[model samples]
Target: MNQTIHKSQEKNMILERTVSADSPRQDELVPSRYALKVGEIDVMVISDGVLPLPTKMLGHNADSATRAAWFSDMFLPADAFDWALNAVVVRSGGKTILIDAGLGSDPDLHLPRAGQLIKRLESAGIDLASVTDVVLTHMHMDHVGGLLVDGVKDRLRPDLQIHVAAAEVKFWEAPDFTRTDMPQGFPDALRAAATRFTREYRNNLRQFDNEHEVAPGVVVCRTGGHTPGHSVVRLSSGGEALTFAGDAVFTVGFDHPDWHNGFEHDPEEAARVRVRLLRQLAETGEMLVATHMPFPSIGRVGIDGDTFRWVPAFWDY
Candidate 1:
């Protein structure tokens, strides 16, 4: 983690808030749940909620008609895509690590039926008060908004340790929330949110950097490109391992080494990181986890012909 002093100029905060984040409505509860075991670590996936976005959001080159066709095959709305948001919990070494908190704001897309991250924790009999750390994959609203309860004061647990990336913090600390191609009001919301982040809850924040091991069984790897300073987690106990790849690639077919969504800050660099991580994860042959991937997004990655494909876990709960 970066111990350097933070300079939260208005410029950087705008850039940071405009970046990518999980999209889901908070009203929904009873988040979908899935379990994976990595050695002695117990990993649980609590559903955050699901958002149906424009099908065109799939790929930059994909036009309206193309997106419609893709959605048509699935019998979904011609113009929409339903994406799921998940928060994974790993319990090992007596350290409870919760990766990516769910949606807290966004009333329009909020799933009055899906924001049960906390309830799921309760259902699993896991105590949120005991959770030691909150590791964010990225600071988009869906991922970090849960740090505080909506419209409530002093919501975050006092003892919880929050870790983010130095690079990500830098991006949001800049001024001018608007991106080059974003909509008009996008920049404004982003800018406002960044300042709120600094003023409201700066003390609990720690900028995660490099490959630091947060616990005896958990190690962090710098895997930016999805959002600047985006990081992935590696959990190992006994001899089993799991790599939590948060939004590096959304779908199996979309996991091309050379492919990247237009939203990426640097498309070329993002593509390179995609390939590198794919190769590394494949060689390890351990289970994988994804934030935006379908429910119970934990599984395996394999080489298919020339590209990689997600091999979803085979089991029914």
Candidate 2:
């Protein structure tokens, strides 16, 4: 009986090895794309790739024990967390609007696993030139880097209109806006990129100060916290709605709305905005699309006493 069992196990191991040899490497496999119907509009959630960040950077203000507890509870590794790089493409009103450009084409500066957005879009049959407008959520490198290709800014396509928050432009443009929160050389890099973008687009770049509609079914609202001009986009058609919460919360952020991320310019203000937004989302039952959450980062928030909980949206075909 023992010999028979051992032979069966050996056979199973051989079968597994054969299957593994036939399968493609994980990195070579095409990333999954997700889609949802918002009334008549089609929303595509494409992935740039996943970024591995230190777990300590998240919930920086929380106590060590609390952070550890949360991480352990979520079954996350203690040292690092895999953060998703997601961007939205909204097709409506005869316009193809990309909410945030993914990490730029370079693979060295960003994670090599990331920066596959352009290829992914092409695979989806989305013509690079068909993207009419790029609505920036903020000036973060991870969010706006895709606008540049081979050192040229706003080169994603020709005759494209780029929209950004006026306040965000002001914050990044100020000569003395240097701060410790930004990565080293970030301010200079931003300045250089901004210069190129302005020169390239010129009259085509539009900056707005307050809440305003950018398209027939899209509007931008200032939700300052992560940055002075960090904003969210509201996509609504018919009665369905989804708010693109830009860095408003990372994974497990909904569970601790008061916890501040290390990258936040104003930690206090960020916490306040998060608490307010989480509560509103929980009560209203509106859908949220977060850039840093897991891939296909669409979900809903639910009230959990003073805090909130993240409920990932069900995958629908």
Candidate 3:
């Protein structure tokens, strides 16, 4: 009996050591999720992955010197900067709404570092089936890519109702959408993805024209510029409000809203929209959640004389 007891204790010790060895480290890059209470609603900010853009592709009108100076001011190298792909999950009105599904399941399409949205969602304890609504800010691949699962079109959360700008849907779905005015393969890719979205979510897709309430406290505001149908989502309750500024204002653009970017479908119009939204948010003192901002992507805009500044949300913990 003494020998048997000794063996059992030894086995238990081994099990404990094994469990300790497998424990996640503090430095590990686990699922990045943040939760905030927007009045009576619960909002979750999650990351799909970070995307690295070549320096030449940034700040369309800004000269190299200006770009370098801006990066230096922030104590960050211009060449090392990346775009954080953020998606939001909102639990309100007895519904689970996901805004901007991330880079999908394949890492090869845009950046190999991305395509972690589904995994991150799972890690965040969010069931894919529980996502009752998907409000896309635009049809950009990065935003809509996660609609797919394992490279199969519309396989990820297919049952969820998708809401998009009516103009955006029509633009991408037009038979003549193969025009070469845009990037070489952009029109084709957009059309293909839009086609799949149309087919798969035909019964579940919802399109809106102007400012319309999508949920009890969520409204889709038309803030065109990045894309014709690109819009921002506004959530409000009891006078407290937050706006998900989907790609309207980028990192540097916060200070230089006039310095248009190369990726904008209409740079001039995009700049106008961005400046207007920035000023409005700053004046209203409301929180702004940007998709391409830093990891948490939750921040606020402050008007600085004629320009604006970004104030990233402080860690509550």
Name the top lDDT candidate: 3
User: How big is the positional error of residue 26 in model 2, measured in Å on the Cα after superposition?
Assistant: 5.8
**Model 3 agreement with the true structure over 1-317: per-residue lDDT tens digits:** 99999999999999989867764345434548899988987899988778777554457577889888888888977675677889999988998999998867543445677767887787678888788888999887778878755553344466667889888887676644321233345556656766776776678778899777778999887777888899999999877889998888788887788876656777888889998999999999899998888878788888888799888888775
Ranking by lDDT: 3, 2, 1
Q: Give the TM-score of candidate 1.
A: 0.79
Worst 10 residues of 3 by lDDT: 175-184
> Model 3 RMSD to the real structure?
5.3
Q: Is candidate 1 or candidate 2 better by lDDT?
A: 2
Model 2 clash tally, residue pairs: 0
Q: What is the C-alpha RMSD of each candidate to the true structure, in Å?
A: 15.5, 5.5, 5.3
Q: How much is 65 displaced in model 2, in angstroms? A: 2.2
Q: Is candidate 2 or candidate 3 better by lDDT?
A: 3
Per-residue lDDT of 247 in model 2: 85
Clashes of each: 23, 0, 0
RMSD of 2: 5.5
- The regions of model 1 sitting more than 4 angstroms off are 1-31, 62-77, 107-114, 151-156, 175-191, 252-257
Global fold similarity of model 3 (TM-score):
0.85
> What is the per-residue lDDT of model 1 for residues 1-317, given as tens digits with 9 covering 90 to 100?
23332544555776656542332234333336778677878888888777555554455554556555656765767655667788888887788888987765653443464455665666677776778888887766667655545642254467667777888778777753221233234445545655576567678777767667777788877787766778888898888888887767677244435544534565566667777777777788888787778887877778765688778878656
